[model samples]
Target: MTDLARDGTHPGAPPPGVTMSAPDVDTHCPYCALQCGMTLRATPQRVEVRSRQFPTNRGGLCQKGWTAAELLDHPDRLTTPLVRDPHTAQLRPATWDEALDRVARTITGLQTAYGPDSIAVFGGGGLTNEKAYALGKFARVTLRTRNIDYNGRFCMSSAAAAGNRAFGIDRGLPFPLADLAGADTLLLVGANVAETMPPLVRYLVEQKARGGNLIVIDPRVTATARQATLHLQPMPGTDLAVANALLHIAVTEGWVDKDYVETRTAGFDAVRRSVAGYWPAQVERLSGVPVADLETAARALGTAGTAIILTARGAEQHAKGVDTVTAFINLALALGLPGRPGSGYGCLTGQGNGQGGREHGQKADQLPGYRRIDDPAARAHVAGVWGVHPDDLPGPGLSAYELLDSIGSPTGPRALLVFGSNPVVSAPRAGRIQRRLGDLDLLVVADFVLSETAAMADVVLPTAQWAEEDGTMTNLEGRVLRRRALRPPPAGVRTDLSVIAELARRLVGDGMAGNGTTGGRTTGSATDGSGTTGGGAGSSFPEDPRLVFDELRRASAGGIADYAGVTWDRIDAEDGVFWPCPAEDRPGTPRLFAETFPTPDGRARFLPVEHRPAAEEVCPEYPLYLTTGRVLAQYQSGAQTRRIGPLRTAAPNAFLELHPDLASRLGVADGDEVTVHSRRGEMRAPARLSDTIRADTVFAPFHWGGAARANSLTNDALDPTSKMPEFKVCAVRVERA
Candidate 1:
């Protein structure tokens, strides 16, 4: 493990106005996807944070990063493990042994009575790389259950699935973050990084500095749009129309890159002919973007020296999300941006560990190193890495929503273990998911705080937060960095790794016994001690985190990641390095796609596109459209950031965004509480009038929950390919309270 700060204290520790010495600690922001590199200072009592050198943020940080210390010892922080008495809803402080034993007994009881499939594990993208890796292994090897998934199903699973299908691999940026600094044009669809990851806005700012044009397409004009050169307000669920229009212009006007198309793409003719009917006027009628603006956007994209098209959940969180992303990728291919410098298709991942979680196969249908669970070769590879025979591995598992819906059903998984996720506040169809959780036989939740999800658990395991843990985290651009602990873990709290180990020991027993999955286990499972189940009778297993990374390096043997030469020694001496580090002498790859595609034929696929209406459409009774997104101060579901002082002060509560005309018609004022309803459920929050929203549209932050959860009204209908919910836009009605 890396050493603690020389001064012996946590970073961001000073009082609101006090000055302190910088602790010789370097780390990344523990909050959002921007992953701004920071220098943390610590004294005996407090920690202070300042911006440091990093490619993504480049010596810049948002308010959340600056106030990291507020959460270290917050009032609501859970300092001890707790267990709820089944008879009464009271939570009593319990020892770690009691909590772990309770979880073990409950899980064992469920498995014994209902079968191994009855138990499930749910992880989160907010977890550190180490924690995520451990959690995934713990589920598959110790629990021996295929019903493992995470909240990423609600975030970027759609984008990841689309990218893998089109590009043959799933790298969010196949390029570096700095590449955007030189682009002459940028087309952003459904992203509001300005409010979510403020440090990243600098790249757009730099683009504007060089006369680069900004084209923003969204149903609502967001904070990022205020700086845009052009904003194309589209109708809900109609982004495919605008995307097809751009492709049509590129094909008809002869702007298509014939060389790249012929050399590196398949299914071009089909896509070309498909877009012929999507003319500007037709697209304008379908989307709300005017014909003139569509033409201008197409021209700007086609004619710019270098154009980058970036997309996020807003475009990917729909029933037709996969098709929409495929269409956008086709447009990028037609514009010849994927393989060139200063131009490419990039996705800004929403969570701090979203990219890494996917890379390590924390999803329902994937394996480590982004290998498919069903593919023979991928299964062989992961099984070999996991020390299990390919045939011994289970088949593809259900997505998060499906898993939640399946609970307590005859065909459903009945037990669940959650780590660092609050689905009651974050998942779509919150009411249904909560009821489903109630139907489960057993529920164990591990988190730093008593999150909404944990509130329903039969046993709650208190775990360390970012400041109280030591691990690595991968940012949006796939940059891996170390997250060192500055403070000791709370009195009765434990690291997720320790808790997972304790549970694994309880389930699998001592290394002396042989289990087919874990080989001859010394501690964890056989799969190289990284908690993977091997082919042999479960043998030797290592419980240490560093050894786990060693096995991960071994598993990525011939691939882009080789960590044989890397050690905590080297990491501490030289700071953190990017992955795909083939050798000790060579530096890690910062950008991908410089040479060739990773596909079998070395060509990218131009997946066909078709538009589908949202699962729920606005009716006369509910005539206004509702969109969900992040607010400036709150992170996903507000588990930790909500406790941060400065951020909480800035946005203490959730408020609905409405157009003045709509608000006036509804007889609602700025502070008036209004109930927003859909077929699924409803929530009441104060309404704020803003001209930025369309007259018939309203907006709300997805972070609000509990009695006022946003997901209660969100449609849980998922994209057919990715199984991601439509959290972006849906039909809803608003009324004055």
Candidate 2:
């Protein structure tokens, strides 16, 4: 790493675009969880994004982050609400009053006909923490529906499930991401940081500069793989076997940290018995990693003074995702990795607010402050803040996939309100989910663009983007960073907070339960949750984000992912406030599990897990494995990134990446048209021959839609615990189109 990489500038170099001295607002990127620091300037022509000093990226920006300003005034950006005409059945421009009133009337009608559960809410990981918090409250208090969940369920639910059972808590990294800079060894199970997060590569380089080893394990030779000291190309859906085998070798080689296991962890004996059969030769035969490479990887990780293990979607998007993550955590534990400074297991969260999104009421099973909804104590505490009885709050709802699958069924909601997500392009078995969404009695989508999902919505409400809003977002490190609005939203666009508040007002302002009231603060009354009348909050639905945060702080005062002390002023003074800060005077916790574990016994647990075949395995009919991932130039579902000119030009179309041997066997040449068929559906794209992938597998980016939609062929088999659909690997066969 050079001094320039550290300082983000040279002696006399010019800044990103506009002068930093004239920066109108300082905030983070609008893309991934890196939340790279940036300064927005009001250039003569448009809003300019210039690199600014911050910890996550050190002022470095990827192409997607650099070109983000283009979306501020994109020609396709929606500036008015669109409502489906009752007679023509076509979306047409409408006033905000008409659109919101129609949605509110539909909501009342559906609930009156089918009950409160007739309405469901879907959120996204891209929303600010304030939005996430308010959305959850809206679903529970105003709508009184038990069916609320978010897209983060697809991103890190597996890792989160594993983390909770083992460590008794789940914070994406549990430590600052910068800690990787001083690590002796880094084992990236399935993450490709070089492309997904370019700025994070600097930490890997620094570790290598210190004579440390960087090991990468994946089916394809990704750009991150090219930078590794050693690359272990395992079979698709077999990384768990590799992890178990490595731990087996560590035990045989006497590399186990017996002292740490004896005192800091539990259930070692069960794990020891579980992994006894995962010998080197067996794993080599099962995973195709070869015994020698496994041995070397085991040695590098086990012998290191301080080593870390990380997992991503490739390893956590399977039916056995939680168990697979547990396998790696088991290895990290056996090596005495976690709870010791830079050496531990962490998940590299994908979305911009993935870490915080799951914490505050967006997920099906959680409430504000990362408290479980089913827990009576948690329910009572949060209900108090909202001025409602604990019994009045709805119970846990269905997870993301199940909610979508049940869309029009007898057990599912008849109406769905979507916020900041595009499941029609991102969901597994998307072709089917698309039809389910179509069956809804009323479908409302809030976004800045007409995404594939929004295109099918009965009502589309244009909402504000990141640069046009002031709120907070928690990055991968659990640090709560402030997002200052560079400018107000365009003329016809409004913030999601405003939309939610207005709808709540329409539903409850007349002292009518959204489902029709019996009067006297019974149903969705005019009261704010507590028995207060018109004075305290003015309206139960407060549109200002700051007011919502004040409520969030009070509600989360004693909860696990505590944000009681994390004020906006505090966030501005410090780089950002880490969570578990219970009071204004107490410093936030940057590194969890540094002293005592948060479990009942004050120790981490060793949960034993085994390798299992993918939900859909290859067969004679479907002889090849298919995996999905993100491309460097495009983000998830390409809702925003694909709209940008430069990004669209960089990755203009989706392509089927196949090994030369496979392409030759199938009689397909580079740029030739090819179609891939799976049990769910099929997708077609131009053939892209690349020896970087395994001969038995094919790859495609899931950022495009229509015939190129890779998700159309993905399996929907879900993890039992997390309900996460297996989006990574499925059985498929290919032929020239």
Q: Give Cα-based local distance difference scores for all models.
A: 0.76, 0.88
Cα displacement (Å) at residue 696, model 1: 1.6
In model 1, the runs with Cα more than 4 Å from the true position are 1-20, 510-543, 559-576
After superposition on all C-alphas, the RMSD of every candidate to the true structure, in Å, is: 4.9, 3.1
> Residues 1-737, candidate 2, lDDT per residue (tens digit)?
22322224331233245344466799999999989888888766888877777887887777777778889999999999999998999999999999999998888888877888999999999999889999998888888888999999999999999999999888999889889988899999889887788778888888999999999999999888888999999989998899999999999999999999999999999999889999999999999999999999999999999999999999999999999999999999899988898888899999999989999998999999989999999987777677666777889999999999999799798999999999999999999999999999999999999999999999999999999999999999999999999889999999999999888887776433346642113333333343543221114567788987877887777888999999999999999999989999999998988777888998889988888899889999999999999877799999899898867876898999999999889999999999999999999999999999999999999999999999999999999999989998999999999
Q: Please tell me which predicted candidate would have the highest lDDT against the true structure.
A: 2
Give residue 116's error in model 1 in angstroms: 1.0
Best by TM-score: 2
- Point out where model 2 deviates above 4 Å: 1-21, 510-514, 518-538
CA lDDT for candidate 2: 0.88
